[model samples]
Target: MFVIGLTGGIGSGKSTAGEIFAELGVDVIDTDQIARLLTQSGGAAIPAICGLFGDAYITESGALDRQKMRQLIFSDSAHRQKLERLLHPLILDEVSSHVQRSLSQYVIVVVPLLLETGDYDHLIQRVLVIDCDEQLQVTRTMARSRLSAADVKAIMATQVDRQFRLTKADDIVRNNRDFGHLRAQIVRLHHFYLTLAE
Candidate 1:
């Protein structure tokens, strides 16, 4: 199956774009969704995470303490890499299975760190980035996630910067405007992708 790696910085509307693609009959497998499943109580990654990061990183409810882990990883690159090492292979396996089973014309694998990870390079046939200005990313993220502006900025700091992300894109969707404009762009891309899938 043709797989487009859909990625963008936090609050860049990657999920919103994935929803639009789903509505248009495309199979959208999001890595973020997969990660959430892995971190849920009794999830597959729980044992490994607890072993590597210790019990304190695991909540009393037995799930990963996401906020705590996030803070830890942001300040400690080694922990971030260790966490990624534990999770990436599992996520990749799940994504591969989904792609093999998919019946759509194509699939979009929404991987927020597509560029950062580099492991999915051979898996994706194309790269599609949903982009907006950095300031707008902060505003949108803060509003949606209820995170402090400083918190949002910290997350943004870890992602590939805007210029680098745009440079790597096979296609870019500018999402700073209204919903109608966003939809219009998706519609155009839908046709383009359909033709490519042929």
Candidate 2:
């Protein structure tokens, strides 16, 4: 089936865009959601995580200690890579399974780190980036995640810059405006994708 890889940096509204596509009756497989499920209590990745980092990174409820792990990984790229190494393959497998089972004309797979990791490149026919101002990204992330501006910026630093990401996009959705504007662009794109699927 035709596949679109949806991506953006932190708080650039990739999830919102994915939701819009889903509302348009497109199948959306979100890697972040898959990752969350795999890191929750009794998740498949828990055993490997505990084996690699020990129980210190696991909460009393047996879920990955997100805050603690975030602090460790963000502060050290080595730790981040280690975690990614352990989880990326599993996430990709699940994404592949979902894509194989999808009944839509086309599928949109949301992978926030699509560009950075390049792990899902083989699975995507096109790349659609949700673009917004850097400051807006920081503000949105800070508001929703309760992260400091510095923390938000730090996360942004790990992602591809706006210009570089835009250069690589097969389609772009500028989400710098209101929800109505965003929806309009998505609707337009939905029609475009439908034509492509045919």
Candidate 3:
């Protein structure tokens, strides 16, 4: 089956764009959600994460404490890589299993860090980037996440910038406008991917 790597910076409307594709009958496996599953209570990555980050990152219920871990890794590169190292393999393995079972013409893997991860390069046939301006990104992210401007800016610091993501894109969806416009773009791109798959 054909696999499309769908990615964007945080709060770039990548998830919304993936929804549009799903509405058009495209299969979408959101890596963010799957990665969460991998780190959840009693998940395969739980023991590893506990070992690496200690008990603080895990909740009493055994699920990962996302906010605590986010704060920890974002500031420390070594801790960040440790977190990625513990989770990436499990995430990729789950993605592979999902892709194997998917019965669609194409599967869009929604990976927010597709470029940063490096583990999924071999799985991607095409890269579709949902893009907008950096200012818009900060605005949207703060609105949706209820994060402070400083918090959003901190997250943006770690990502590949807008121009860089555009440079790597096989297709681009500009999401600075309205959702209707985003939907129309997905419809057009869905047709294109379908044709390619055929």
| lDDT values for all models | 0.94, 0.95, 0.89
Candidate 3 segments exceeding 4 Å error:
none
Poorest 10 consecutive residues by lDDT, candidate 3: 81-90
Candidate 1 — worst ten consecutive residues by lDDT sum? 178-187
Poorest lDDT segment (10 consecutive residues) of candidate 2:
153-162
Candidate 1 lDDT over 97-190, as tens digits, reads 9999999999999999999989899889999999998899999999998899999998898899899999999999999998888889998998
lDDT of 2 by residue, 85-156 (tens): 999999999999999999999999999999999998799999999999999999999999999999999899
Which portions of model 1 miss their true places by more than 4 Å? none
Ordered list by lDDT, greatest first: 2, 1, 3
How do these models rank on TM-score, best leading? Answer: 2, 1, 3
Position 54, candidate 3: lDDT = 88
Clashing pairs in 2: none
Q: Point out the higher-scoring one by TM-score: 1 or 3.
A: 1
lDDT (10s digit) by residue, model 3, range 66-111: 9998888788879888888877888888899989999889999999
